[model samples]
Target: MGFISNVTGTLSDSISSELKDQHLETFRTDSLGQDILVKRAVRQNSFGRNQGSSEIISAGSKVIIPAGTYALMIDNGKIVDSVTEPGIYTWENSSSGSILSGGVKSVMGDVFDRFRFAGEVTKSQRIYFVNGLEIMNQTSNESLHLPYPDPVYGTLYFKFKIMFSFRIVDPVRFFKKTGKATTVYDYMGSPALPKQPFTEVQDHMEEALNLCGSRDKVPFPQLLSNKSKLKDAVNETISEVWYEQRGMVVESIAMTGLTLDEASRKRVEQFDSAKIFADDPAALQALVALGLTKAMNSAASNPAGAMTGFAGLGMAGTVAGNIQNGVSAFGGQSVTGPETCPFCGTPLPLQKPLEYCPACNADIRSYFQGMS
Candidate 1:
């Protein structure tokens, strides 16, 4: 019995060596998590008669073997007892012994649950947001002091601190597209602009400013005064430009700072002061009345001017009354009020009749009566 056991062990070792020498079996796991075992038969090599230099084989390549699990096999021709552990066994003929069984068993283990990927914007990519606060310096002369630099004449230098938030909507797609998680602004930082600045970004800002019009006409500030409208407009604009154009989403755009040269600053200040004068309530009203009178006279000259002429006249009269009211109001003359609060002797609210004290609830009737 001892001799027989020794012979069997020796034969098993030989069989294992033979199977390993000749590529016999292979296994592969599919993407759907299925394992496939492949078997290939050993064939004569037609290449050269020299038995082909002790052909080295790896586990997954195919080769022929006697009816037994040979390549990477576990228990000798038996079903694996535990599903967690897999066994492959091979039976081979040895020169020393007739029948030999050799096998290997292993517990298949997994460390990673699933494959993952990270993504980022490439250096070639350019990203930016539309700023509604930038307005066109529509003055004919360049000396009018533009808020932004004129690329045509001077060296324009500015830094933009863009803020954007993005979430991975499609992990696979995002990984395939961008390749890593990174902000688009990171890509913009490299390759400092000396010879050729970001003219494209400047152009886009100009376009946005043009779309927004002048500061007074811009709807952003006005909308921002109302939180609900500001949010809605911001969301709409961001989605339209960022997502629709660049496959990105901008959550918000804030014009945090603006700078201009000393000359430009002085020019802007002068322009602003001139604008203030031009937009003075009394001045604007006077201008509107004059324009309306001219339009009324022009309408009156026509043959079918009856309706239009009367409408023009009504518009002119209304404008004139508004101008007079504005001038009078600006001259410290109240439309309807006592100069002082009746009960508290404080300055009364301008342009409205005072009946009672809003703060103290004191009856102002006696005070008004005393004034009369």
Candidate 2:
């Protein structure tokens, strides 16, 4: 104790006996409230003015530190004490400034002693509560050009959209980079900066893609088909680089869209055309025969002597339609054959062969459609 006699003499000389106009210092952070983060009022004197805010701390004042919030006590813009634990604390002049100190109960005698004490307050006293929840979210408005191999096109450029979320994990680092040490701020605090740092995230994601070397294995023509794998690979890369030292955690990353460039789009269209021909090579070879069949079907539609030129074509087209529709089962039984599973010897799940059977992991495509 720094001479109780001198402390008492100083208090008696400075304060008045009358308690009518006496102001007690008290400060509770908005972060210590029900919301994830809260806003405090400006100083009483500066209520309507843009001058500044005042932090009040008085003896016996109750400090409530809530959950999911990190509270700090700043003396003239410098952090002096912090309270990470949620609890109620009453100030006593003689006790240490830090909230978790054990000496508070032993030193504080009563309201009179508490009133006589003036410990937590300094030349400039303020309390700040920072939300620990994940609030930072970023989305790529423009698609990133993702380069990948194309089996047919060699190299393809695909645009990708990304969404990511982050949380503040370190209070000290956050305070340093945020606004003025004295001002209160939130997720979108800075006017010049975005709510989240998307540009940095994009760079990290690109680096990850380069490291994974997915370009070597997949081609641009087949890029859209491999979307799931691409999303996973990029997400994994972001997780590793989202540093905790920045006092933030990257919570989630999602790939929302993938689109091809004009050249690649045209190439894909051509590939689809080639695929159609390859799938039905016989039809392409038999185009003249098909035209004749179509002419026969048109003549059959009218069934009149006026359609004399298309009479043969109409007949051939009708026969062709019947042959195309005839391959499947007419009633319960197939005119072609039953689509039985080759493996478990059960009927196929659907009329046509699917990738696999639900009941017994059998490849239904093994059974030919036209075999009796």
Candidate 3:
């Protein structure tokens, strides 16, 4: 029912010398790649012919488990034993009284009970190897829309392209969920494999992105640099579907691209332009000067008359010139002094002391008075 570690000179007691010579052969698998998740083991007959599908594994068959792979001994469509360690294993029939008398029960008692099978009577058995390496390059063409809240720019929405990888941490659970295939289970390439994990991750991506951005207070431009937090948030979001049920966990994620839609881009540009002028008074004064130049050019070509246009231009120039003095002359509108609100920087709305800022609702009375 289970495999015992192979020891020299011990097969003669359980198997006849002639039978051992015919049946005892090593069963080992080669290194598996990221795409291949599982592979069924095969054997050859005494005539060196391939035993395909209907071969019965005789007692005393040696199975070698290499590093980064797990082997399972299945009998009659049920998992009888499994080997996670890398070494040589010899199959010992539990029904054989001679082998069980030598304290083989202590070796396989817990494993046999785990699957609720006392022993396997028939020789309908097979060996399978599971790849334990990290499967990489799992990509999704679907774009995830992340709504990121920026303290300075309000909420900005963006689309992101993410690439992620996963590894099988619990082979037993994974094998149970995805049973034995004909020969190989191609996790990445096979169309027969279910696309639950990929689809589920994408389905939950938006929520995870929101949680990551909001919880960590990451700005919209910094989401790409915060890939680690995003990855953790995504894994935590889909833990029930991907990790708990499928025995697979996301190993790493790389954010390939982040882009804003046209509308969002225009909004950001407008805000960015405003911030540049607000942060630097010299920049604002330069913009006002440009406006004055355009007005004078339009006045010279005015159809009313050169003198009449010049009169209008003089009034516009006065208002433009006052921009440098932190106040506008037209309608006596005050251009906020250099001191703006510390929180939102919204010019403090005429610099009058107020209890709260109307833009961001921050208590600005103390801050406004201190600046005044």
Candidate 4:
């Protein structure tokens, strides 16, 4: 029979306490830490070894399920009973027909088969407590590099570390899928558990970041502050693997130590320098004047006579003056450039047509293909 729920203080006082220490009656778990994912329940009697299922769990036995945990009873290598709510339960051994009852299916053979004896199912009975508290893993030290579309800087490669917290939402699925039956399942310490899902998250990082950059309009540098958007994007990408299959969900994700790669940083600086002269006619004229002074010095040192050098220089000076006159004809109005990325709506700092949209990495060739 499955474990039956018992109301508090409902156990009758008429029962005799004559043979108290002979068999284990009560099962409960001690304090569980944050990182401990699962632990086997402790039988009340410590001195005597439990030789059989009867000695381990008997009729009229009590199971104390505390808050923030789930308890499941394994009988004959199958999970026959479980209690998700926090309460006292009474074990009734009247019938075995309730095997795998209470909406919990039998434990998958492939997972718990290793505990069987010589290819035979044992009569062993035990209860395991799965931690229900939120489990926070260590901050991943490995850097995740992704292409980010910045309004001001265009497309930039961002390098950052990640941290996240998850919790077991379905104990049955978790126990069935985990395979290993350790006395205590530590989420962070598990070799296979952490790597598979985290690697999936890393593999899908680019897709998620693209969603943030394009759909959410989140800037590259603001990701650290916009934890909710980043968390949602990642969860949406890996939900099938982590939530649907594994019965766990990423509750929160923090993107930390965010920075642009060296090449991307230099590109931003170069763009900014060029953008200043492209927008400001006065600044461009000043720069042109400085170049002319340097050219005049080189012309005086020419092997050709100074008069010939001056004559050529005078022609160049006339061209420079005409360009300055054209600038003045604009009535000192500031020169304007291309303002935004066509694909993702990110602001553009440069006026000239680019081969690629910096914000979304969309090929600009298609946008300008038929232009004059």
Write down the lDDT of every candidate, Cα atoms only.
0.35, 0.50, 0.65, 0.64
lDDT per residue (tens digit) for residues 243-320 in model 3: 788777888887677788888898889998988876766777789889888888888899998888889888766545
lDDT of model number 4:
0.64
Model 4 misplaced stretches (Cα beyond 4 Å): 1-24, 46-56, 92-122, 150-153, 183-194, 266-372
Write model 2 residue lDDT over 202-289, tens digit each, in one string. 6666655553344436554344465555555554555543443345556656656777789988887887777765566454446546
Tens-digit per-residue lDDT, 1-372, candidate 1: 997886666555444443333333222221111111122223334443223113222222322222212222212222111111123322232111111112122100000100111111111110111111112111111111223333222222333322222322222222223333233233223223311112223234443433333322443223224333322333444444434443333233333343455665565566655676556656556666677778777777857767877776775665455455545555534434456554443454445656775445677777766766
TM-scores, each model vs. reference: 0.25, 0.45, 0.63, 0.56
lDDT of 2: 0.50
Q: Pick the candidate with the highest lDDT.
A: 3
Give lDDT: candidate 3, residue 141: 67
Q: How do the residues 19-134 of candidate 4 rate in per-residue lDDT, one tens digit apiece?
A: 22124367888545575677777677665643333423544467898888888787656777878889888766412222223311222321133233222332356678887777
Provide the lowest-lDDT 10-residue window in model 4: 9-18
Error of 3 at 97 (Å): 9.7
Of candidates 4 and 2, the better by TM-score: 4
Q: Per-prediction RMSD in angstroms?
A: 22.7, 13.1, 11.1, 14.6
lDDT score, candidate 3, position 93:
54
